[model samples]
Target chain A: MSGSIAVAGLGPGDAALMTPEVATALADATDVIGYIPYVARVAPRPGLTLHASDNRVELDRARHALQLAMAGRHVVVVSSGDPGVFAMAAAVFEAVEHGPPAWRDLDIRVLPGITAMLAAAARAGAPLGHDFCAINLSDNLKPQAVIDRRVRLAAEADFAIAFYNPRSRSRPDGFGRALEILRDVCADERPVLFARAVSTPEETLHVVRLPDARPEMADMRTMVIVGSSATRTIARSGAPFLYTPRSAA
Target chain B: MSGSIAVAGLGPGDAALMTPEVATALADATDVIGYIPYVARVAPRPGLTLHASDNRVELDRARHALQLAMAGRHVVVVSSGDPGVFAMAAAVFEAVEHGPPAWRDLDIRVLPGITAMLAAAARAGAPLGHDFCAINLSDNLKPQAVIDRRVRLAAEADFAIAFYNPRSRSRPDGFGRALEILRDVCADERPVLFARAVSTPEETLHVVRLPDARPEMADMRTMVIVGSSATRTIARSGAPFLYTPRSAA
Candidate 1:
């Protein structure tokens, strides 16, 4: 039997956020591969084998999934959010590029899902309504200088910025440094959203001004959204609604 | 006899991509309000009233929906993609902000979906795998200079740029001018993806070098993605895979 690999997104910790296409792909796959948490999300079936790996072994995991597919096993590589956005899809292609030329022709498809930023945006009140930039703030794979430069330029462009992997145990200060850079360029009290574990039971949203935003507010599960200059807050009985207007002068 | 408003996304013309959360909102809604085509996407039901409006009347439509909700009607405002991204969520919030103070207490939520750029990115490879910025190219609400500045800054920052509403008949030259500006800053022949009517029966994807790209390649139905400097293409028998790696030096 010929085999294929589908890199699917299991959207922001919510089953309802998952696309039906992804659900169908998971049902058809013979093997599932991903980080432990993501792999745990897929229900175990009699015929399906689950290979859950630890964090930071993306390339190795990608290669393994490809190897299995080449061995005529339909494999599904799952990521917490959209695989294309800082997830397994790129790594899968990177493996395909380094592997046999024939491997490039394998049936590899990236199924998009509701990414964390968009999920966080929905939980908050459309903070990404206007022009926005998404920057992965974990300086592990990329250089800190590159992260800083992107943050500065994004601030200069006045785009609302969504930061993924803001503060991890190892890189606790990266998000703090990013906040300092924002403060230097932007003095306005534009609201910043700290959306943690969105769509989950532990989901907590904090809206603070640039002056009051602390790096401690973010963890590995948090998605930080800094609004554009035009972002505003409308206070209500419950959580305040935040949004950036579509028009930009 | 209670009321609320749900600004939902009808994921790029695909029933499979529509989230179950949005589906639940539609099922619970008493009135559905949106652009003509988007409202038409919802099926006729016994209890549901469809209020389809023309384009360019977003705020008016928003106000009407808000009024319906205020009058104790469960309303669902629909957009083609995630309502938070250049769509109806902001407009609904805007209406609430400008309307009576009591409107703030009304139940308003933004349900996320598979946005156009993400859908297009998945069909193509992970061209948006790295840091990227989303910019709306229509100058109806914003100034031409604003779009120019954003395109230039985004190019300078080396962020994969996603252009929504890239070209309409009335503003044919906006996308062309944006391309010219990208060419001025970026001499490299980065891959430009024109994904038109993605996830629909009329779906067509064109990958071209920046120099060869033309204005007529896009329309209101198209989403244009210009790859970052890190973007690369892998040749295959069927269609080439385009992706931007997750890491940068």
Candidate 2:
């Protein structure tokens, strides 16, 4: 059999949100490789093997997947959200770029899925209806200065911002500093959406004003969306509808 | 039957790219409303009514969907990409905010899908693997100044930028000006991807350096992605792989 690697996204947390393309890729794969939680989402079958690894060892996981594929195994790397967005696709590509030249010739395809930010935006109404920026809050790969500068510039641009990896056990203070910067720069009553584990059984969406938002509201599983100046709320009986209008002020 | 409005994304173009959640919503919907082309994507059935309206009639279409739902019809407002991203969700919310108070009581849900930028990014490798911003280059709702400022600020922040509606028949010169600003600000050989009709039979992807990219290379159907400084390419026999490294330089 010809060896291939398919990096597929499983969507946020819902099986229904996953694309048929990704589902087909998973079905055809001989080996599924990803972080523990993501790989666990895939059902094990008689012919399929699941290789779940630790979180921070993305490069090692990528190398392993590549090695398996090079040895005539069909490998699928599963990611919770779209693989291209802070997921396994880039790690696999990073490995391929620096690895043996023969790895570049392998059939590698990235199957897109419903990303967390978009799923979160959908759950909370259309807070990202206008121009928006998605920033990864974890400073493991980038510097805090880079995050601060990007947040400041995004606020200045008045773009709705979606934050991923906002708070983790190790990086608890980064989101707090981000909130402080937003409060300082935006200084308005724009809505902030704290969407945790969206599209899952534990999905809980909280909409608060900028002044009232706390950093502790978000965790590693949470997706945070800060509204632009134009983002407004429509008062309803239940949770208010939060959406950024197509028109700008 | 209770009245409901489900704002659903149909994914980029391929039927496989559409989520099962969206497919289920469409199957259960009594009426489907969207732009002419998008609505035409839906297969006609015995009971389902597809309202395919002309372009620039988003507000009217939204109001019509609301009216139908209020009359106890299950209406699905469809968009090519995720409904929450510069699509029908915001338009529906805009109508609800200004329309009758009873409209707020209706059951409304936004179903996320594979957005054009992400799909495009996946096809060309992971160019949006790092911090990125999505900007709508259409000046129909916002001013040209707002787009220019956001583009400038996004470039300054070194965020991989995705441009939607880069050029239209009515707005021909805007993308050119935006390109000039990018060239002036970036001033590097960073890759720019023009992904048109992604996932469809007519799909075409072109990659070029910043200086070599031209405005006419894009149209309303194209999703243009400008890579950040850290974005790189791996050359093989076929088309090169484009990806942005996870690490910041």
Candidate 3:
């Protein structure tokens, strides 16, 4: 008897934000698999098996979770943000499709959660109110060439951009390079919003011009949003928010 | 004694997608105020006061909810998607700022929830994998000049675009005008993904080129995602998904 699998979103932070369906799915699961921090989000429940690993081992962890589900154990694959938005859902589906035959029959559902971009946008009074995009600056899984191309395209198009996984100790200059690409195509005065650890205790939101932005301000936990050509920063009560409208109206 | 206010996001659709926090908030609220359809979403909980109205009266409803909150009645202002994403959250804030002085001391925490764009992107297998923007095609709140400018900017920047309130019974050509602006600036062959009632039982998602898209297929409930220059559609298992990459790698 193969048990089903649910890939649940834990949301930005706080256990209360978890959907009731996600909570029930995690509670009933015999095994839970995710990156270490996300796995820690759920408190210890009865009859639960935990699989946690570093960032590099996500594919393997997903496969192992699927295997557990195939072995007649309920499993919940967890992700910090929406699983499908550069989170674990794609890997789960990829593994299920390319993995062994026995894994094919397992039930799968991808539950939605609060994404960092949206949380950050909300915190900053709608930085994403207009046209925008999100780019992960980490070059580990993807190449620098590709990141450069997307950044150039986003900049050239003047789409507001949110930078995820923007910086880490290993790749100090990746964000810098991406920023350069954006600056080249967009105007120097474009607004760049930085939201670090959005919704968590350490959450911080900064709205600044492109020239004033610094790479040291971001980290793995930070999400960066850059405004489009039309995004304007108005000083209200000494705090600025980025807003773009559907129309000038 | 002032009653607290709860800001809730009803996910794209499907009551099961409601987060535990949102569910608990809705369940515990004495009154829920929102557009009529959103008010109907809450399960018939005992002791729940429902304030439903037409779409045009959102600001008025929000003011009424604030009055309830000031009068020491627990009230929840509900938005169908994430309250912040072109929804009720901003209106709530606006009302609080401009409403009667009695509302000044009230505590407000803008809770996070799923946005339709995110849910639609998830259902479409990551059309938002890279960078993107969401533009509302409705011209009621804004002018057509602003809409055309933003659409052109998004296309020039090559940002994936999610169009909200794309079409309605009265303004059937709004989406068509948006498409015209997009086509003028971006390639006419850009991929456009359409998602309706995302995450709900009536959810539907399809991908077509911009040139082939028809305004007749869209309505108020529709969300149209137009891919960037780099976005590509791949056929998998007899279904199509728009794929955008963080990097070409």
Candidate 4:
């Protein structure tokens, strides 16, 4: 089938939250391509070609998917959360914008999906209420110097920070480095919220001081939110959600 | 009708983006209440009692609606973006949590909605690619000192800052004060993105340097996104969107 390509957001790992349009698009697509885990979430449908790849081969996989689209296959490039929020939307656009000549004319629409930040924020009861920032501690493509600079700036601004790709087996100390930068710039007593597997069955959220969050508590899949000084942990029924209001008063 | 109230997120501002479940819930509600502007967006349907209120009376309106629900009316409390992200969801919970004695037993479901931050970020082509923070510049309930401290911290952390409730006629100098504080902490050359009326026809996005942005450009309806030092303006085909990459390669 020949049609415009759509980058759909499968909101927050739950199939129920997927937009009807996205669901239809996925069903209609001749091929579905994404990171293995994200692609695995969709139930099997008849006549759909699933192209899954390892996490590290994103660019290559994206290029291959675009080429499939160029070859007259309606392809849906999937991402776990909203495709644009650090997902496959940008990668697809970058491929089309800078890739092979045959893939330039394909129609691409980015469908909104639930981002982890929004889902996690909701799960954590509004840590993002005030100004907040998200940083991916994965230094695979980015240099440590740049990450440090951004982290330092975010801490100085007192923006609550959500750290994605915080720690992985290969890069174990990334989250630690980020915490160090934030602690140095902000206060050590600042509230840091660690939300592991947010929205999933293994979801765990805890409020800890910046100094108390250790590397062992986080992994690549964990999304950590470090709040500004104004952020406080309020306990409701013995559960704490970090909240930063428009004003502390 | 007095089962439970779910405040689900209608993604961004488009009906197409709204989740099916949320749309279904809205359709099934006997009473729907919200700020007038948001209330106007819902397509007419039979048996839906629409309660539209002024912006200032959101909390009161929410309480009134919840009371209606508690009185066995199927009620739906609507907000423009995600209800939880600085919207009516929190007010609903707050009312239930701290309001009069009658609200204790009402089943409260704070369904996630697509927040303006995510919508604005999408419109601006991923200004929230990395760590960023959102702060409401309105000092109605918050003190200026608190706002200043948070802005300073976010700037220092180098977050892409999204400013909600940026300005109003009475608080004309709010944005100016924020800009000044942000300038002191962040680089003067950092890009500031003003998304006025996002997800609506009159939507206009302006990208300017922090030092160059004027106070008159923003008002209460505007959501300002200030990019990190890593954020860059790609002058592609005379249109620019603020982008912060997962990595600063």
What's the TM-score of every candidate structure? 0.98, 0.99, 0.81, 0.82
Give the poorly placed runs of model 4, Cα more than 4 Å off: A1-3, A43-47, A96-106, A143-156, A177-194, A201-214, A230-242, B1-3, B28-30, B43-48, B65-74, B100-106, B145-153, B176-194, B205-221, B232-242
Model 4 chain A poorest ten-residue lDDT run: A240-249
lDDT of 2: 0.92
Report the TM-score measured on chain A for model 2: 0.98
lDDT of 4 by residue, A81-199 (tens): 78777777666655555666555555656677777777777776556655566677765777778678878766765667777778865577888888777767775587777777776
lDDT string for model 3 (A1-249, tens) is 768878888888967666776877887888889999999887886789888878866668879888787778888989998776777776666665567766655576677788888778777655565545677776475666766876886666556688878886557689999877777777569778888887678877777799888888787888888877766664555456456543323
Return whichever of 2 and 4 wins on lDDT: 2
Q: Relative to the true structure, how large is the alpha-carbon lDDT of every model? A: 0.92, 0.92, 0.74, 0.72
Best by DockQ: 2
Please state the CAPRI-style docking class of candidate 3: acceptable
Residue-pair clashes per candidate: 0, 0, 16, 35
Q: Best to worst by DockQ, what's the order? A: 2, 1, 4, 3
The sequence of per-residue lDDT tens digits that candidate 1 reaches over residues A1-249 is 679999999999989999998999999999999999999999999999999999889999999999999899999999998999989998898888788897898889898899999999998898999999999887486778888888999999999999999986657789999999999999989999999999999999999999999999888999999999999899999999999987855
Considering lDDT, where higher is better, how would the candidates rank from best to worst? 2, 1, 3, 4
Fnat scores for every prediction: 0.87, 0.89, 0.38, 0.44
Local accuracy of candidate 3 as per-residue lDDT tens digits, B1-249? 769777678877777667777888887899998998998988777798898888866568778888899888888888887876777766665666566755655655566788888777766655665556677666475666666776776676566788888886545677899887877787558788888888666877777888888887777788998887866665555455455653424
Of candidate 1 chain A, the 10-residue stretch with the lowest lDDT total is A137-146
Q: What is the interface RMSD of each candidate, in Å?
A: 1.0, 1.0, 3.9, 3.3
lDDT of 3 at A81: 80
